[model samples]
Target: MDPHRLLIFREVARTESIAAAARRLGWTQPAVSQHLRRLERQAGLPLVVRHSRGIRLTEAGATLLRHADAIATRLHAAEDDMAALADLAAGTVRLAAFPSACATLVPTAMTNLARHRPGLEIRMTQCEPPAATTLVTSGEADLAVLFSHDSRLPDHGPDLQLIPLTDDPVRLVVPTGHPAATAAAPLTCLASTPWIAGCPSCATHLAHTCEAAGFSPDVQHSTDDYVVVQNLVARGLGVALLPQLALDAYHHPDVRALPLATTERALYLLCHREALQIPAVAETVRALQQAATAHRPQTPPAT
Candidate 1:
C-alpha cells in the first residue's frame, strides 16, 4: 500500500467519515474517496462500506487500519527525533497523566522545567493509566505519568520503560468524629462499614487491602473524583480508600485520613526508550521524578 494513502486511510478510520478526513486534511471529499478507492483496489478487497451519514470499516479495513496506525506512530517518532536534532531547547514534550497526578505532580514539574529549560514546550493531557499508555505508545505523547496498584504490575512491552517515581500510599478516609476515626490504623475497623470506592482499579486495590485485614468491605458508593469521594465520606455516607496524591490535591476538612495497613500504589513515568535520547523529554522525566519525590511523604530521592 502507498504509505501516504495508508496515513489517509488511518485518518478516515479514526474520524469514521471520508468528508471529515477531507476537511481535516484540506482536501476535497471526492479526492479523499478516490484515494480510498485506490487503496482498497490495491488491497484486492473493499476496506470500508459507504453510508448515508458516514463510512464503516469492514473487517479487512479494520485489520489494515491497525497497520496504518502503526505506520503513523513510526512517522511521528521520526518527526520527534528530527526535531530533537534541530534544537533541544525548542523541542516539545507531550505528557499525559491521570487527574490526581495532574493536580499534584504536574504543576511542580512544569514550573521547574520552565525555570531550567525555558524554551522547551510541555503539553499536558489528562488521562487514566490505560489511555495514557496508549498516548505514549502511539507517539501522541512523548511520555506519560501513570500509576498501578500494588496488586498489578505494568508491562507496556519492551520498547517502553516504566521509571519508578514514588510509592503513593493509599489512605482510608472516614467522616470526622466517626467511630473509626479514633481507631488506630482502622482498616479492619471499617470492614463492616459502608464504603465509597474510587475508580475501578482503586476499588480493586481497596478490596485487596481490606481482605488482608481479614474482612471484605461493604462498598456503597462509587465515583471517579476524589473530591466527590471525600464529600461522600464527609457526609457519613461511606468511608473511602484514596491515594495520598488525591489528598494532597484537595482534602475535605470534615474527613479524617489514615494510611492503609499494607497497600501502596506506585507512580511511574512511562516512555519509549528512544524518547530519552531527546534532551527535552529527558529533562521533563527528571523534573517529574523530582516532583514525585517532593509530593511523596518521607520518600527517598530517585537515582
Candidate 2:
C-alpha cells in the first residue's frame, strides 16, 4: 500500500469520519474516500465500518492504524534528525503537560529553551498526567511532563521511561478569612470542611492523602480546572488540596495556602525509551529538569 494512502487511512481512523479527515487534510471528501478505497484494495480487507453516527475501525483497521502511527513517527523523526544535523538548534519538540504543570512549568521551560536554542520549536498540549503518559507512549508527543503522588510512581507503565524532575509538595488551601487559615494543627483539623477536587484520578490522590491523616475529605465540588478550584476556595465555598506548583501559578489574595505536614508529589519527564535518541527530545528533557529545579517550592513560613 502507498504510504500516502496509509496516512489518509490513519487520519480517517483517528477522526472516525472520512469528512473530518478530509477537512483536517484539506482534501475533498471524495479524495479521502478514494484514498481509503485504494488502501482497502491493497490490504484486501475492509478497514473501517460505517454506523449511523460515524464510523468505527474494524479489528484489522485498529492493528493497521497502530502500525501506521509508528511508521509515521519514525519517518517524522528521521526528517527532524536530518534537519538537526544541518542546524542543531532547529527542530520541534512536541510536549504534553498536565494543566497545572502547563500553567507554569511549560512556559518557563519554553523560555529557557528559546534563550539557549532560539530556533527550536516548542509545542505544548494540556492533558491530565495519565493521558500525558499515554500521549508519549503512543508517539503522539515527543515528551510528556507527568505527575504522580508519592505512592503512584512505582506503578507507571513498564513501556515508558520516567525521569525524575521535581518532588512537589501538596498544600492545603483555605479562604483567608477561614478559621483553618490560622490553625497550626495537621491537615486533619479541616477534615469536616467541604473540598473541591479534580477528576477521579486526582481525587484519588487527595483521598489517599486525607486517609493518611486519619479522615476522608467530603468532596462538595469536583472539576478538572485548578484555577476554578482556587476560585471556589477563595470564595469560601470549600477547602482544596492542591500541588505547590498550582498554588504558585495562582496567587489569589482571597486564599491562603498552608503546607501539609506530610505528602509530596513527584513530577516526571516521560518518553518512550526509543525516542530519547532524538537530540530534540533529549534537549527537551534537559530543559524540563532545569525548569523544575529552578522553580521548586521554598519551605513555607512557620504558621
Candidate number of the best lDDT:
1
- Which candidate tops TM-score? 2
Cα lDDT tens digits, model 1, 78-178, are 99867754565567889999999999899999998888777788899998998989988998999999889974666597899988888888777888787
Off by over 4 Å in 2: 1-83, 154-156, 301-303
Clashing pairs in 2: none
Clashing pairs in 1: none
Write candidate 2's Cα lDDT for 94-140 as tens digits.
Answer: 99998878888899989988998888888999988778877777789
lDDT agreement of model 1 with the native: 0.86
List the candidates' TM-scores in order.
0.69, 0.69
lDDT of each: 0.86, 0.83
